[model samples]
Target: MNLFADMRAVVISALDQMVADGALPEGLDFANVAVEPPRDAAHGDMATNAAMVLAKPAKLKPRDIADALASKLMDDARVALADVAGPGFLNLRLETGVWAGVVQAALEQGSGFGRSDMGAGRKVNVEYVSANPTGPLHVGHTRGAVFGDALASLLDYAGYDVTREYYINDGGAQVDVLARSVYLRYLEAHGQEVAFEDGTYPGDYLVAVGEALKDKVGDAYVDTGEQVWLEEVRDFSTDAMMDLIRADLAALGVEMDVFYSEKSLYGTGQIEAAIADLKGKDLIYRGTLEPPKGKVPEDWEPREQMLFRSTAHGDDVDRPIQKSDGAWTYFAPDIAYHYDKISRGFDELIDVFGADHGGYVKRMKAAVSALSDGRVPVDIKLTQLVRLFKDCAPFKMSKRAGTFVTLRDVVDLVGSDVTRFVMLTRKQDAPLDFDFTKVLEQSKDNPVFYVQYAHARVCSVLRKAQAEGWDMSDAALAQVDVSGNTHEAELKLAAKLAEWPRLVEIAARTNEPHRIAFYLYELAGELHALWNRGNELPELRFMQDTAEASAPKIALARATAIVISAGLGILGVAPAEEMR
Candidate 1:
């Protein structure tokens, strides 16, 4: 039961009545007419711009149309008042019973309270954390992983059929570097001293992979040259590294529905198929690219290369699909991968990339546009860097990942719930600060704990009520009569709860899962504020000596808990029953 939607429907119906009365023109488009919370809460509970948007089209003055619309809207039983505000805005005040109904609906729906059908069951493929299988995931990858997983869950709650995917970068030179590094470790396993050069990975995480290679083949490639063991070790090492990466993702509560291998596109004619699809549309050609502006590579020269006409589809320039040496460029496999996604019949595609890949976004979107003929839309979200801090100082690097902090390191320091929540506390494109000390603090300054504490507090209320022999189970709460409660604080919390369905649609439509986190924080704040008010007014408390007197108040508290669980569920955070 979305009260905002219910109110919007009432507004639209009233507008239709105005059209019948000839106060407004017939067949006017009402798509732009929106009913939402006023900018200043002091204005009214809700405001609609129907008159403002229709003024020019209807050949009427703004205030003139608002005056007529306001009178018609005031007739609805749920609308307490409809006053024409500045220029043309129609501000609405809903009856207190309307907010009371929202609390009752939340208690009835439980965790399914805010689930929406905004997506209409469209299939969406979300590809994220496609890091090279060279080592365990680092802090940067961790942010993308958490963001992507939460997004998938959010879309699912919003009624999108989502598939979580990982595209393995096994066809790159990085994997070959990993192969050579593991080979050196293999030699060390055979009792040979080895020194890791500048380009080789020196992390001790590969030590076990090397030792495992010895157990599997018993030094068959001992003292052998690169040709004898390069390919074999490359495949073996990539698998091991992928296993390590999978484990790291698992520890962070991420599980992918698919792992697409870049190497598969190499020998499988997939790249040719994708390129041919674009070439058929006259988007592929051999061309010379302009030298990058500002700073050109020292070896910069205009060379003829196979290029995709990405400029036709919104990119700055055509991108090279094949290098001058006739080798497939890095962009080739990415094109094939997206083409594969389109062929799978997904209605939409979403890629979660690091901020460094910002330049790559336009080209990837262009490729998908050309492949799907603009039928399937692609949304690429770039997550910015995460700066770690401890005790007000930047956290040190991880020895395991060799260069940056590993995902496990952050998760180990705080927890998976805190890591995920803190990672999403900011917009994806904005840089985030992950302070170890601050996140672990049990204070309102910490958003994760604050939201969790609200849930825990609700549970405590229910437990205390139960101890006092007040029946508070779902079945029991359903029997509560909410007709007696009319406190402004209680009504304010119900109003917040009523916004959940609307919030889900807004967050999903923008493809921003962080919005859900932000909304949950606000909702929790309202709930906590209401709970705190009970200390000053005994009548507002959840438990009462008589079940007849307590039912309505406790029912409101139960309803608040229900909405909290639903919001937290979308964020993949467990609603805490008790705070430690």
Candidate 2:
């Protein structure tokens, strides 16, 4: 099904035959030998470095090896022409029948055409959008949510057992701040005047939580001290905020398999257990710390503290695990969380964080490395900021969120499909400018619209064929003789379809789902180009003089739609049957 892989095998088989016939030496490692598309399409359909890589190792001239290999390759039915390019690289032109087979495979497989088994079922835990449960998710978290969810889907398609997770930052000073803020709202609900001071939240979203608290407890905790209501309200308010966050994520089509609470690590001996495991390895120590590189503070002095020898595992410096007063530091709980994940027997781990957390990546990876003793691998991806523009100017912040635009604000304005697709239009590590006016524009300049329009066009073609009383189902179109689809545009589109499986494997291997977005856009361009060509040449049209004659052209259009739907599915965007 993967023509690139199939051709690579053919090349390797020919080289083995060369070794047997004494044209090449025995025991040359073919691991680095690669077969890929030629850099310039004018050169040929495929190119291989088999001759170049083997020349030096085989103690033979590059040109001499290439000549012999070309002769052996021409014997195969798939290779129509094989010739040496430059010094020794072999460029190949596959038979036209090869493209026909690719089109048939796409029709036969439908959306499953590019699914790969490269992961071999390894368990991968993907933790993303672990924003503190202080309020509804904002635009920054939305990018992380979309990126993480799409990555989980891509890994699943590549055969990894992926679990989507969210780590709640509840056991922190931030939650206490949220409780006090909600208490002010609660007092307001009781008809009492209260001011949201500098340290409290003033967002209008918490107004309902305050009113709901009044209904639950009546006047029980009215005018009570912090000792009486802080704990109870903290739990109550955290639950409410999480409900809001969950609803926000649901609006964007993101669902987590697990919502891990940081509070559970405390009073549970988990932090101590993680540290104990490190202690057993002599990585924990009581040592003096050095001053920071810049101008030292006037109150600064060298002090001994409990630290983890993080540098032993790849961190820049030894990190403190506990304060001088013996309370656990912020990094301790994170280490414990990852230790718990390692104990859960996951084979790999991935973390999706906002760009501001770039400095935190090294230490987190070091913690997992030290915890798993290099038995498992962890990759951390950081999503950069999103700048929103509306009406050709900077968009205003949401009054409901108080300081920033919430996830629902973006989704409500442009819809979940547009929001999701546009968020991934740029790389996670690169900043993205999302223009409201431009994204919704019905033109080729808009990537999401371009891709969706291609799918809709295919649907339109199928409908027209069906109304003409032709059988246009996948089973029937798959059986069509597509050898007659020899037009330059038709063959070019089919060649692009042949790249899907290879592209999926590359994107999955690099943990970059944005590549999928880029590929979908390019694939859509091919379909659009071919569709436009049909207008110039009547013979290139999908609907021909007869139904039987129209079968091949319709089959090509249907195959393009199948691949688009599959790519969009991975991105969590529903394909459009018809665009308004």
- Whole-model alpha-carbon lDDT for candidate 2: 0.93
Name the lDDT value of residue 476 in candidate 1.
77
Q: Write the residue-wise lDDT of candidate 2 on 1-580 in tens digits.
A: 8899999999999999999998888989999888888998788888999988888889899899999999999999999999897799899998889999999999999988999999999999999999999999999899999999999999999999999999999999999999999999998999999998978998999999999999999878887899999999999999999999999999999999999999999999999999999999999999988898899999998888999999999999899999898899999999999999999989999999999998899898888989999999999999999998986788775557887789999999899999999999999999988899888999999999999999999999999998999999999999999999988889888988998998898899999999999999989999999989999988998889899989999999999999999999999999999999
Q: Tens digits of per-residue lDDT for model 1 on 1-580?
A: 7778888898889889999998898979989898888988777889999988999989999999999888988888988989887898889988887877777777777778888888999999999999999998999999999999999998999999999999999999999999999999999999999999969998888999999999998979998899999999999999999999999999999999999999999989999999999999999999899999999999999999999999999999999999999999999999999999999999999999999999999999999999999999999999999998887898885657677678888888788999999988999999999899999999889999999998898898788877878777877777666766788788777777888888888889898989988988888898788878888988888777787787887788778778878777777788899999
Candidate 2 C-alpha error for residue 440, in Å:
0.1
Error of 2 at 402 (Å): 0.3
TM-score of each: 0.98, 0.98
Where is model 2 poorest over a 10-residue stretch in terms of lDDT?
A: 391-400
* lDDT of all predictions: 0.89, 0.93
Lowest summed lDDT window (length 10), candidate 1: 396-405
